[model samples]
Target chain A: MKRWIPFILTLALLVPIGAEAAIVVVVNNANPTEKMSERELIDMYMGRNLYFANGQLALRLDHSPKSSVRRDFYRQLVGKTVAQVNAYWARLLFTGTAAPPHVIPDKSEVIEAVKKNVNAIGYIDEADLVEDLKVVGRID
Target chain B: MFSSIHTPLRWLICGSCLVLMAWFISPGLVNAQVINDNDFKVSGFLTLGATRGGDEFLGFRRFVSQEGVFEDEWSYKTDSVIGVQFDKKFTSNWAATVQLVGRERIKNSFKESIDWAFLKYRINPNLTARAGRIGMSIYMLSDYRNVGFAYLWARPPTDFYSLIAFDYYDGADIVFNAPLGSGTFKAKFLVGSSENKFRFNDSAAEFKLNNMFGASLLWENQTWRFRYGFLSFDFDDSINQVLGTDLVADAFELADAFGWDGADNTADDIRAEGESALYHALGFVYEKLPWTIQGEISYLDTDYDVIKSNITRYISVGYIFDEITVYGMLGKGSQTSSRTKLPDLPDSLSSIPLAVQLRDGAQLLYNASYADQESIAAGARWDLRYDIALKMQLDHIRVEENGTVYWASDTLPDKDRAINIVSINLNYIF
Candidate 1:
């Protein structure tokens, strides 16, 4: 029973860590690209560069502004908080310079959108990722 | 009575049309998914603000009882404005955009003014050509100067931006965007002419700029950006009869009496006609997470003797803490006006009646040139909500020489003065 207690405590600690490790960036299975650098992701998401590595027009999708996943994704990918990202977008939008990514309601919709559109790219929890989507990048 | 009613009715119809269009487009926009592939998109920003000063500053009157007079008190119309924009994509490579802005200026009520109306043709992904009424890209923030939400300050430092008040020109431009190393490089060339009607000292004047041309280059990386721009324009203030009216006529009449060969031509030469100017600006911005620094310097050289050459610069630094940001800015402007020495009025002409008046007129012209001023500002911005921000700022301004920059009344003291201004604003975007 003493040995079992140690193993159970370790398992409990690893569960949340494992869950956090599941955050990843995903693209359509048909995209043909296997991976993306962090800089490329930042450019597309921030409306700086609109073309993907393959010269294909890129479409960006986001989790809802209120989502914890969205906040975590931006923090990991761009080192900006959700509020900072929102403020940045406000500058672009009000200037008629660029538009932000279309926000989806949940991780499921993000997955569905990316799966159906070859140009679409999104971020989701690895646990929610399916075989139909290609994992292009992973949040460290 | 009919004429007054007619004008208001026309404005009402225009206002209603804009509201209806916004209503129809807001839903599709709010439902982000519904407008992902739509043909039309609508967006806008609004800023409501109140400001007060310990002394008269920046032409903001403390009360409506006087015009162009400096007063010390609170005012609401200084920084409040609203803007709306609509974009429509007709084809893969064709698009059109229209933007309207309303603000309290020389008028009492909000008057809808077209800020930009342009048609765009995308020759390729990297290049675009646009024609119509386009925002002048002379300065770093010129394109979005009125959009308070886009900037960190309740207002851009007026010391430098107020040098040229025209924001748009009727003409065409071409923009090129290309990838350079890990960064992006953008170049824009514009050619346009602008006409402006402005009120100075309760007197209105019309200014027409001809053959205006400008070019700008910007290179931006993940953490840093550098920009350089140049502009040249031919200025004509011939229609501004108010300029030197009381003195110019007397000077010319005196010249004719003295049998000066170019008596009539002298007024034209000194009247700011066919005057030309060259402007150059260099600016940079560095942003890395919680730290931001931005600075710009500009130089203007003009042939108009009454309008002295000037140099202006400002630097701003800020730190972002979660949803709050605190910043400080320092700015300075200097003008070099060469005092007209009256060309050593001949001893024989010293006895003449009009000769003395002409010399006095020239002195007034030199005095009307811009003054040397310095400003320091500290401000904080808080993101109150996803689309709303609250900002409060305090500024201390000192005029070193002539204090003509703030459009003070003739009755106000023209010598050096110091003023403090406190402003608060709510900026929102949708």
Candidate 2:
């Protein structure tokens, strides 16, 4: 009976935890460029090099705190964790130097923010991409 | 041939073949269900630069490092550094981070080491507690000053941050956030002691593990923000007793030369006395259509036995125009002690007392002291690119003793001024 109970709980928990989702980079449709290399995307997102292909300052949008897509994107591209990002941002904020990218609650909000400004760029789950926002890059 | 001829040989050959096969195939098999959710990340930055300035009394003009060691005037070096941070999240409410910095300060120490290492547990939406090497809440820029790309200037106002250089403590802190009608307010409480030892002259200097407490409240909206903070530090005397004695002796020798046996030595007697300091700072930043300005003011008080109270204040203003930022600062402070009291001393062959000595070489010369200082600086930043910025700054300092200027040198180009500094820095982040 004890073994059976453990097996039942494992079955209930494993199903949802194993699911995988798509990762997509979203930029304003008005932005001239439709594609970006992984390196370019990294440079842009990390605040290393900010000029877009059209030569305008790229204002980045980020996911709200602890969002799954935010975690996935930074882990894959920037190679940092959420806590590290927080620490990094703290250093920036207190130093009166750089500020973090703007953040929105979810993919829909990101799309809205990006659609309004040509300089805006963000990422969302592949399933969440809206038509008005262009997908500039994809992470497999 | 041996395997075919003997059982032992056959077993050995079979084992060797199995090991070789496993080595090539095991890795692929092990990779089947590693289950990486892409929830870990790594990022970092590097800052490398050299500085030169005029009238560097004690080499105070360059970045804070050992080699500068209080040298005077023209110097160059790159003790600037690079650091990397790693962060991971195991669950929604739990996260961890480790930061490693490499700098020339600690014998080229590679371990900039654990600026913040802690496990954060969030009870609900508005509260969290973290225990580990927690950052101090004392000064606004203390936690982040090491990262240059985060700020427009090559460095923070040294006059303020340098006085209290210790910014991190090994301990735990709690934070609470509340919504206050169209704005949010946050409060943080930290209690801990520094585990590291700071040594001077080949021995550990005094740094008491006294209570360190601070409270700050910040309110922000789309275009405006205001913050106020108070920090109270309790510590035992950190000055070396031998050094204290030397200072006292110097004062007494000056007094004796003037034959002022009636003058007060209260200042000299206070040497080696335990002292404490309280620091308070306030700042307000405003951003609106086409303009952004920030102003900060700070006041600090240090109470020591022999020295008069030290009061210091710094005020700064900045304006943002597109990608260009222009700023300036005015700082002033003073340290003074009462001259009313005199230490009695025998004069000539008589035990009789005479007029209280006020001369520099008089016996009571130690009781009379003065330190009045003021600094003015102006600078600007131009963002040539998003991640790259160019900044230039010029600063002038004036020192006054009892309403009369002192210590001014010709190279400084101004009396009562020891140094005039011109600095330029290029800042970038990766």
How large a fraction of the reference contact set does each model reproduce? 0.25, 0.09
Query: i-RMS, every candidate?
Result: 3.2, 15.2
User: What does candidate 2's lDDT look like per residue over B1-430, in tens digits?
Assistant: 6635443233334434543553454321111122232245444554544455434332342222223323234332322544555556565456665555444332322223456666666554566677777666655555666666655455666555444446467777776765564445667777776633332333444445456666767665435557777766655444535234445546555656666553235434554445566667777665453444555666655565434455555666666665677888776555544433433454551343322322223322222233366778888877665345667777676654331112212122223434566666665443
Judge candidate 1 at residue B231 and give its lDDT: 86
Candidate 1 lDDT over residue span B6-122, tens digit each: 332444345456656776766432232422453587777777778776444345432211233235656555676677788887865788888877654443233227778888897
Q: What is the TM-score of chain B in candidate 1?
A: 0.85
In model 1, what lDDT does residue B300 have? 91
> Which stretches in model 1 have alpha-carbon errors above 4 Å?
A1-22, B1-24, B27-36, B54-69, B107-112, B237-250, B253-256, B259-269, B338-362
Misplaced by over 4 Å in model 2 are A1-140, B1-38, B56-58, B62-81, B101-114, B195-209, B238-274, B306-308, B336-371, B401-415
Best by TM-score: 1
Cα displacement (Å) at residue B386, model 1: 2.4
- How many clashing pairs does model 1 include? 0
